[model samples]
Target: MLFDTHVHLNARQFFEDRDAVIQRAFDAGVSYMVVVGFDRETIPLAIEIAEQNETIYAAVGWHPVDAVDMTAEDLDWVEELAAHPKVVAIGEMGLDYHWDKSPKAIQKEVFRKQIRLAKKVNMPITIHNREATSDIIEILQQEDAKEVGGIMHCYNDAVDYVQACLDMNFYISLGGPVTFKNATMPKEVAASVPLDRLLVETDAPFLAPHPNRGKRNEPAYVKLVAEKIAELREMAFEEISEITTENAFTLFGIKRS
Candidate 1:
């Protein structure tokens, strides 16, 4: 069984055939998934989806891209949702410098708040990093995010930064980018990150794996990401799947039965 550690099944892209897409993921041997919800609309939907699906879980937070829009009430709401039985983590929150929708200062402040929230709730957080890797790392360190170890979701950064994330008790998650032809960094990260500290995701409805590169991504395609990682690490596909699934369970505090 495979665990897709990050997926946006809550996104509108799956609105029409969400259930069907979930079934396909199961059929593809993806036994577990975490639907990350970054804003108001997707947050509630994430919890709702998790409530309906036994093997699926949810993460709630404000997206860095929309940092300016997240109010104190929104933060309060996310904290309340964190108490939900199906809610396993506190973020998809971090810096996204690629977009100017929210200024860097606001994004950092928002990211810091979410990290503090995660630490308070004693739950892990998932990071959404773009070109703002350095700032994200600095804030994570400043916030002492290591107290509540989390995931660097779909980590596409260089190998040099991998050690810092690991030092902060963060797991490096490889996604569809690792399988892309011209993507060298993710490939390097895939090969170098420790197996136990490794995870895989699709970030679905986005970043579909190679061969399906330009199409809509889904949890079903996580197997392709796993397959590529296995190839990169020179390990058996089943081994990589099992280890990563176990790693995810450990990180998310999921007591697998």
Candidate 2:
């Protein structure tokens, strides 16, 4: 079985076939998935999905792309939402300098607020970094984020900082990028990362892996992410599945029955 530690089922991209997409994921062996709530509208929608399905779970926080719009009241609302039994984490939040959707200062501020909120709520955080690795690491360090730990969602290639993230007690999650033949860095990082500290995600409705590249991604494709990691590490497919699924379970505090 597989556990996709990150995905966005609440996104409008799946409005018409969301249920079918979820069914495909379970059929594809994705036993669990974290449906992230990265905005006001999706936050409630995410929790709604989680509440309706045992395999689905929610992570609440504002995305850095919308950081400028985040406010103290919003943080308070997220903090409150974190109390839900189905809400497992506090973000898919971090910096995204790849785009200028929000200024760096606001992104950093929002990231920090959510980090503190995660600490306050005793839930792990899920990070999103895009061309903002340096600032993300710095802010994480400054916030002493190791205390709560989290997943570095959709890690592309940060081999040099793998140890740094590990030191902060983060599990490195690989996504579609790892499956791209041209993506040498992510392959290297996937091969080199310790299996115990590795996880797999789909980041659904985005970043679909090779073979399915350029198409809308789905949770079912997490198997491809795990398979790529296995190929990169030269390990058996089943072994990578077991190891990463366990890693996800541990990081997200999901208990096996």
Judging by TM-score against the true structure, name the best candidate: 1
State the weakest 10-residue window (summed lDDT) of model 1. Answer: 248-257
The TM-scores of all predictions, comma-separated, are 0.99, 0.98
Model 1: clashing residue pairs? none
* Residue lDDT tens for model 1, 68-164: 9999999999999999999999988999988999998899999999999999999999999999889889999999999998999999988999999
Clashes of 1: 0
| Candidate 2 ranges with C-alpha deviation above 4 Å | none
What candidate 1 gets wrong by more than 4 Å, as runs, is none
How does candidate 1 score on lDDT?
0.94
**Cα miss at 113, model 2 (Å)?**
1.0
Best by lDDT: 1
What is the alpha-carbon lDDT for the whole of candidate 2? 0.91
